[model samples]
Target: MKHEMGRSDLLRRIQEVEFVALDINLYLDTHPDNMEALMDYNKYVYELDQLKRTYEMNYGPLLNFGFSPSQYPWRWIEEPWPWEI
Candidate 1:
């Protein structure tokens, strides 16, 4: 099923992704030989990429491309900050 997540929900998802990514990174540090954890980490990375792309497309770019604007360039411009929801 498809989800029609709002901006706040999307941000929350991104935060979850960040936590999962960090957790996976720490897991890999200790269990570097575990193929299952590595696979899961790869999957999480892919999901994070998708989330970031969706966010950027709707809200403006988040990271710097070689020829693009730097990440967080307009950090002060207020939209709905994450806590507003």
Candidate 2:
């Protein structure tokens, strides 16, 4: 993330984190006593949020709720959708 990454790269990282979290979540469902797995799940979820915010700030809302009042008009609509990239 230190180096400038393309939009797709950031998107991919977000997916990677989510994927990790999803697996951990499934494991925790069966092994509810695994505190370590719970911690990891929280970590990945946090990372995913950070990445999504960063992407949305520079690009636009990833979801309808991602809008953060902007001084420059509602330019979120101008940005190309993720798949359009």
Candidate 3:
């Protein structure tokens, strides 16, 4: 049966996807003409965005400093700090 992912699971997924996207980004910097790599990069980027949005919606804002919007009473402050998470 499918199970719901916890906060830490979501965070881990985001980190993994982000790492893959960054690695592909660096590769593309050296091989700009690689269509396959470019396509892969785009796919991963889209996945990363979706994952972050899901995480934020379930938990809270993943970022501060105007990167992520807050809800009533400033929900960002309600979530645990990054280190605590």
Candidate 4:
């Protein structure tokens, strides 16, 4: 089932995923032999993938997929204006 999340909520979630990915990436870089960190990093990566998929499926694709999928011609539209939320 899909939940109707506000644009701000989606943005916040994506930011969280980015932060976790960065943290895990840095940990792995410094402690390459740490199995637990590696596992956590993998988990975070999977979460990030899922989050992206959810956002794209619910809203429009966050990044261009090389071709447009919208029924009408599209232009870059900013997410709900920052102040509107």
Candidate 5:
């Protein structure tokens, strides 16, 4: 019973993962000695990377300013703005 995620759904997932990773990052800033927290942070970061890659592949680049490469015809402008999503 696997469900395929749509564009917005995938974007939401990416946001959620990003949030978790950031929260863990802040926690680690004060508790750098916690190995478990560090491991969880790494896991979430990897997941975030994969989700971002998948989103770019299915839709378009999630960023600009040399952060993401665009195909011919300049896809960065072609895709909807972040607010539109």
Candidate 6:
């Protein structure tokens, strides 16, 4: 299912996965014994993590700080601001 994804598409996929995880999280809050939901949640979370890693590698930090490492004098600052583009 993997293909060349632009930044916007990748961001959309990441958000979609996280939203699914969040809904599952709410379901689990009331039914903590649901192993099936738990497994689904875990799968989505792992996919989200991989997406984030891919995003960071190709397009700077998805976050404003913290998750991004100081690889080369904070190149994130040089990336085009979302509002500017």
TM-scores for the candidates: 0.72, 0.78, 0.89, 0.69, 0.89, 0.84
Instruction: Report the poorest 10 consecutive residues by lDDT, candidate 6.
Output: 76-85
Per-residue lDDT of candidate 6, residues 15-71 (tens digit): 899899999999999999999999999999999888878877777776675766544
Query: Which wins on TM-score, candidate 1 or candidate 5?
Result: 5
- The C-alpha local distance difference test score for the whole of candidate 6 amounts to 0.79
Clashing pairs in 5: none
Q: Model 1: runs farther than 4 Å from truth?
A: 1-3, 63-78, 81-85
Instruction: Report the lDDT of model 5 for residue 17.
Output: 93
Q: Which pairs of residues collide in candidate 4?
A: none
Q: Candidate 2: which stretches are off by over 4 Å?
A: 1-3, 65-72
TM-score of structure candidate 5: 0.89
Cα lDDT tens digits, model 2, 17-66, are: 88998999999999999998999999898888888778777777665554
Find the 10 residues in a row with the least total lDDT in model 3: 1-10
Better of 1 and 6 by TM-score: 6
What residue pairs clash in candidate 6, if any at all? none
Report model 2's TM-score to 2 decimal places.
Answer: 0.78
lDDT, candidate 5, equals 0.84
Candidate 3 differs from the real structure by a C-alpha RMSD in angstroms, to one decimal, of: 2.3
Model 2 score (lDDT)? 0.77
- Model 3 TM-score is 0.89
Candidate 3: pairs in clash = none
